[model samples]
Target chain A: MPLNITLTDYGVGNLYSIRRSLENCGAEVTVVRDMKEVLDAECVVFPGVGAFDKTMEKLQPYREDIREKLLSGTPALGICIGMQIMYNSSAEGTTPGLGVFDGDVVPLVGKVIPHMGWNQVVSDDPLMDGVGDRNFYFAHSFRGNPSEDITIGTTEYEGTEIPTFFRKANTYGTQFHPEKSSTSGMAVLRNFISFAESVL
Target chain B: MLTKRIIPCLDVKDGKVVKGINFKGLRDVGYPPELAAAYEKQGADEITFLDITASLETRQTMLDIVSETAGKLFVPLTVGGGIRSVSDMRDALNAGADKVSVNSAAVKDPSIISECAESFGRQCVVVAIDGKRVDDHWEVFTHGGTKPTGIDAVEWAKKAEDLGAGEILLTSMDADGVKTGYDIPLTAAVADEVSIPVIASGGCGSKEHIYDVFAQTNASAALAASIFHYNECTVGEVKEYLRDRGIVVR
Candidate 1:
């Protein structure tokens, strides 16, 4: 049987790429609109790129529930703004995040603002295992600023290294858009599903 | 270090990819999905779909094409041409575009850039500026490079950055179909003025042209059409040339 992945849809941006990418990786994807249903999933995925406040609008109220589920060893993957909301606050918007991790989302330090394009990742974590190029597609101006040593991956931009992937138990967060990141990105989704299956 | 990007642009007219010479004399090539997939396989860092016939009537067709192509494309997909307002940007984004490139409309109302940045994130907003060299300075052009705006190319790039455009797609009108190489001086001026990543468009015939832009200026990506669409060389082959010449590519 295929592993069922519950994708949260708060109606901010297109959920097609991530949903379709997950399906391509051999998972039975179900995009759940309700916060209550999101908690009762085989695996959870917070995957998209949108404004922080707009994305956290419908998801803000259930912060405690989402955090609790993630903390209780739920295998989850967060990408871009999806990963940003795992922090305490974001400089991008006024809305408060779920605060799953002790951090804030701040602007990426560089001469260039968004740092849009492909960049090599520095990580030896199992999550990055088997990625052919080790280079992931990144298109964001801000990244998660974790307070502790939960950093699993880092990418360099103009002599500055930003913590891109943060890990806490079975939950993982990455600032890159894996779905739009070509084949190496597919390796990430494939690895995530396998990791989700093991934990579930 | 962040690797320089190599992008292949596909001009779509009513859902099918087309080829044209300097924005004139068009010809049908292939569907968006297959060509995009082929380029992606060839290690294209990103793919752009320019709606040459981006009229109000064919707007829905472009959106549908974006939806169809994005479903099968793995790398970042940028859709340009015909994005006049936030609603248009929203439609393209909702239809699965990773980024929306705004041209002529942005010149009329600069606030459109900020609005789109506010509605979506700045990362999804790309400002495409078409410029041509005239006398001693480059001039910004709109309406498919037919109508000339008195805006200075360098100043407009800086203004677009100030107005919250994430990236700039700087295309040189003088070099569109010439394909000798990218307009190095024109590209260098805007890219040096903007703090955001700039993708140099137009005037690329060989892999050497891509290398020239990256080595000659701060342009982050190089966008081409006829060179790659005609199968002169694959994007993978271009990367090999860049890598061998000491430029890092993913």
Candidate 2:
């Protein structure tokens, strides 16, 4: 049986890659434009695209409901800005985040503003099972800074360790776009599918 | 550590990938999605579609190609050429482009850079500078690299960054397609002048040329067309060559 995934489309950036990638991974993906649909999802995917505040444009109203659902272990996946919104707030935007995690999303301290391009990830989690030592593509200036306990993966850049992956309960958020990270990234998505299948 | 990138550029015209000699005498190669997918499998860090279509009538064809290709790419897809305004950028991004590159439109009015950056986060805005060495410094060229804007390439790069450009696609007209190597001094000057990452373009005939650009300059990535188009070398082969020479590539 295919795992039913509800992908949120808050009308920010393109969701083609994420939608296509999830479908290719053998999941029945449904992109819901209305933010409220996220609450009732069997499995939810919050894609990382667009500005932080603007990304919260639609979800701001239902922030509490969505947070409650996710915290109750609703099988949620957030990427980049999607992950940022799960925090209390972000330096990128003035709007308040969903507070799924107990920390704030902050700007990365580095010479290069946006840590663009591929970088190595260090994690022994199940998602990294077949990912091995392959690097993942990243393109963002800000990242979530929740406590180290929730951070399952970290990627070093210019001597600073940037948290790239977070997992708490049944929810997971990634700073890097697994959909755009090519084959190794696909491996992570595949693992997530298997995870959702097992959990379901 | 962030690994250096190798991007394969697909110059498309009228819906097909085309190869040419110094941006002229174009020849059709293949479909954009088909070619881009192959490059992705070959370990290309990213794929770029440089739409060289000449008329307004054919621009939609390129956008259609972008939509088709972007739907399949697992890697970041950047589209360039013929993009003029924020509306044009909207069309491309809405059609599924991750980032859009503006050239002549930006050189004519720098405000477009900030506007586009404002409209769609700066990370999605890329300013492409076609440069040619004259006397001691390089001058910016527009209109398909046929007309020189008399703007200093180094200064323009800095201004673009200041205006909120996320990255600079520096193409050296003097060394373009010559295959000797990237114009190291020119690339180094601009890269050093700007803090934002720069992608070195043109004059990449061999893997050694790829090595020279990365080893000598601070460019975050290097783009090539002919070398990978003619099967002279694959993105995988170049990466292997770079990896063997103690340079990190993805």
TM-score of each model, paired residue for residue: 0.97, 0.96
Over 4 Å off, model 1: B20-29
Candidate 1 pairs with clashing backbones: none
What C-alpha root-mean-square deviation, in Å, does candidate 1 show against the real structure? 2.7
Task: Tell me how each candidate scores on DockQ against the true complex.
Answer: 0.84, 0.79
Supply the TM-score for candidate 1: 0.97
Q: For model 2, how does the per-residue alpha-carbon lDDT over A38-140 read when each residue is reduced to its tens digit? A: 8778899999888888889999999989989888878888988888888998998899999889899888877776788999988888988988566998988
Model 1, C-alpha of B102: deviation from truth (Å): 0.7
CA displacement after TM-score superposition, residue B63 of candidate 1 (Å): 1.5
Q: Give lDDT tens digits, candidate 1, residues B140-207.
A: 99999999889899999999999999999999999998989999999999988889999999899999
